[model samples]
Target chain A: MSSERSARSRHRAILVLTGLGLAAAAILATLDHFTHEPIALERERRALAALTAVLPADSFDNELVTDFIEIGIDGLAMPARIYRARLAGQPVAAVYDVTTDRGYSGSIRLLAAIDPDATLIAVRVLEHRETPGLGDRIEVERSNWIRQFSGRSLDDPPRQRWAPDRRDGDFDTLSNATITAGAVIEAVRRNLEHFEVLGESVWSDPEDTEHD
Target chain B: MKPEHQDIWRQGLWQANPGLVQLLGLCPLLAVSTSTINGLALGLATIAVLVCSNAAVSVLRGQLRPEIRIPAFVIIIATTVTVVDLTLQAWFHDLSRALGIFVPLIVTNCTILARAEAFASRQPLVPAIHDGLAQGTGFAAVLIVLGASRELFGHGTLLADADRLFGPAAADWTIQLLPESWEMLLAILPPGAFIALGLLVALRQWLIGQTGALRARAGQSEAAA
Candidate 1:
C-alpha cells in the first residue's frame, strides 16, 4: 500500500513539474510576441544611427541605410556591407562596415566612410572586445584616438606609413594599446585601398552585381 | 511593517546580504560591475526577476511537492529572467546592449534560486515579496559602490556613460573625478573586482564586530546599575 502511494506521489510530481514548464513557456511566448517588433526597430535604429554618424547628414540626400551593397574584401574577416551616400544623383561617399579579428582580445568591427576622392570622411568603432581602460580608447565616446583617421587617404599616408607610430608609421597609437590601434589603422587602410580598387563602380545599384 | 516583515528586511539587507554576506550571484556581480551604469542596469533587471520569481514560488508553494520543487522553481526563475531580458531589449535598447549576455545570464545568478528554495518556498506571498525587495536592494547597493569605485579609480570618472542607463538627458551626467590622462588600469580589470569585494566584505564584518562589542559593553553597564 505504501509503495503504491509512493508511485502515485511520483506521478503527481511529474505532472506538476510539466505543468509549470508549460506555463513558463506560455509566458515567454507572449512576451516575445509583443517585444519582437520593437526589438527589430531598435536594432534598425542603432544601425541607421551608426551609418549616419560616419556619413555627413548634409552631404547625403539618399537614404544611406537602404542604399548599401555587399562585397568581399581581402582584409575583412567576412563579406562587408558598403553603404553609398549621394547628393542628388552624384555619389558623395561610401561607408564600409568592416570587421577585423586582429584585436588583442577578439573581433573589432568598424565603420569607415570614404569620400569620392578616396579621402576618409570618418571612422567609428561599432563593436570591439578589447580591454576597457586600455584598448577601448578607440571608441569616440572614450577618446579622440579614432578621429585622427579623418581626411587621411592611402596616398597621403604613403601606403606604408598608414600604421601606428609605434610600428614606425605616421598615425599615433593609444597609450598601452598598440595592438588595438594597429588593427583599426590597418582595417581603415585596407578599406581605403579596396575603395580605390572599386572606384566609381561602387556607386552602382546593389542588385546589379550579377552584371559585373 | 509587521515584526516578521521587519525581520525579513533585516536579514535580506544586512544579516544575509546576497553580495557581501551570502556571496551569491558573484559572477554577474563581478563581470557587469565594470561601470556604475552597467551595474545599475543589471541590478534593476535582477530586482525585477527576483521579485517575480519569489512571488511565484511563494504562490505555488502549496502545490509544489518536495521531489519536483527544484524543477518548478527553475522554470519560474528562467521564465521571469527571459521576460526581463526581452523587455530590456525592446524598451531600454541601449542599456540592454551595454549589459549584453549578463542580462540573459540572470537565470543562473544562484541568489534567485537560493531565495526561491530557502525563503520563498516556505514563506507567504507578502514576506517573500519583501525578502526579494530587500535582498535585491542590498545587492544593487554593493554593485553601485563597487562600480563607482572602479570607474573613479580605473577610468577617472563616475557614471561615465550615464546616457546608456538613464537615456539621453543624462548624457552630461558623467562626473570626471580624475583628469583624462590619469588612469589606474588595474582597478578596471578583473582583479580589481576581487579586491573591491574583499574590502567591502571586510568592512561589513568589522562593523558587525564593533556593534557586537558596543552592545555587550552596554549590557554589562546596565547589569551593574
Candidate 2:
C-alpha cells in the first residue's frame, strides 16, 4: 500500500510539471504573435535607413530582391542574392556582398556597388575588424589602396587577370596589408564578372526579383 | 536583506560570473557580440528574464516539496524566459529577430536553472532579486565590453547601431575612427571574435593577478605590524 501511494504521487508530480510547462509556452506564443508585426516594421525601417547611406534616396525608385545563381568568377563558385535598384525605369545599381578569404585575420565582407552598365561604382567595408594598420587598409578611407579599381574597365582587368600590383596586375596592394588587399581586389573582380553574366536577369522586369 | 543573503548577491557577480566565471550562456554571447549594440540589446533581455525567474522561484519555493523542487524550478525558469522572449519580440522586434531563436533558447541556459537551484529555491525574495541583478549585470558588462572591442577593431567604429539599444537619439553615438576607405576587413570575422575574446580573457587574468598581489602585500604588512 505504501509503495503504491508513492508511485501515485510521483506520477502526479510529473503531470503537474508538464501542465505548467505547456501553459508557459502557450502564453509566450500568444504574446509573441501580438507583438510580431510592429517589430518587423521597425526592422524594415532600419534596413531602409541603412540604404540611404549606400545609395542616394533619389537614385532608386524600387528595390528588387532576388536569388541569382552565380557561376565561376575569379575562382569563386556559389549562388548569391542581388538587390537591384531601378531608377526611372532603367537599372541603376546592384548592391551585394562580396566575400573573400584573404584578410590578415580571416574572412572579409565587402559591399560592392555596380552601375547597370556592369561597371564597379564603389566598394565599402561592411563588416571586418582586421588588425589595425594592417588588414584594416581594405577601407578606402584608410588609404587610397582601393581607388585604383574604380574606373578600370572589363578589358583592362581580363579573366583572372586582375591582381595586386605585386603579382603584376591592374590593382595595387595596400602597403603592409597585402593579403587583405589582394583578397578584396579579386573579390571585386569576380563580383564584376558575376554581375556581367547576370545582367539580363537583373534587367528583367523589376517585379521579378521579389522572392517569396 | 540578511547578512548571509548579501553574500549570495556578491557571489553571482564575482565567484560565479555567468558569462565569464561560469561560462554558462555562450551561444548568444558569441553570436550577438558582433557589434556593441547587438551585445547590449541581448544582454538587457537576458537580465530581464533572470530577475523575473529568480523572484518567481523565490515566491513559490515554500510550496514545493524537496523531491520535486528541481522540476518546479525548471518549469519556473522556462516560463519566465519564455515570457521575456515574447515581450522582446513584441516590443523590440528587430533585436528579437536578429537574436532569432537564441531568445527562445534562453530557457535552456544553465545559469538560470543553476541560480534557481542554488539560491532562489532556498532564499527569500529580495536577496534572490539581488543575485539575479548582480549576475545579469556582470553578464551584460562582459558582453558590452566584448561587443565594443569587436566593433572598434572589426568595423572601425563603436556602437555601429547605438540606436538599437538606447533609441534614435543614440544614432549619433557611432564613432568614426577611420575613413570609409581604410577600415580593415577581418575584425568582424568569427576568428577575430575568438582572438579578441582570448585577449580579453588574458587582460582579465592580468587584472586578477595584480589584485591578488596587492591583497597579499597588505596581508603581510598587517601581520608584521
Top-scoring candidate (DockQ):
1
lDDT string, candidate 2, A1-212, tens digits:
99999998888777766766787778777877776786677766755554454567888787543322233344542444456678877778877655566667777776677787777766676556565546766666556666566655577677556888787876777766677777787777778877776667765644663531
Q: Judged by TM-score, which candidate is best? A: 1
TM-score, prediction 1: 0.92
Task: Report DockQ per prediction, comma-separated.
Answer: 0.77, 0.28
**Candidate 2 ranges beyond 4 A from true positions:** A46-54, A63-79, A96-111, A124-153, A156-161, A164-185, A198-201, A205-212, B1-5, B13-43, B62-109, B138-164, B168-225
**Interface RMSD of every candidate?**
0.8, 5.0
Q: Cα deviation in Å at residue B170, candidate 2?
A: 4.4
Candidate 1, residue B190: the lDDT equals 92
Q: Per-model TM-score of chain A alone? A: 0.93, 0.66
Return the clash pairs for model 1, or none. none
Backbone clashes, each candidate: 0, 20
| Predicted complex 2: CAPRI docking category | acceptable
For model 1, what is the error of residue B76's alpha carbon versus the real structure, in angstroms, after optimal superposition? Answer: 1.1
Indicate the residue-level lDDT of B1 in model 1: 34
Give the per-residue lDDT digits (tens) of candidate 1, residues A123-162: 9999998998889889998789999989999988899999
Candidate 2 per-residue lDDT over residues B48-104, each given as its tens digit: 888988898888786666788887887787778777776776676656655667788
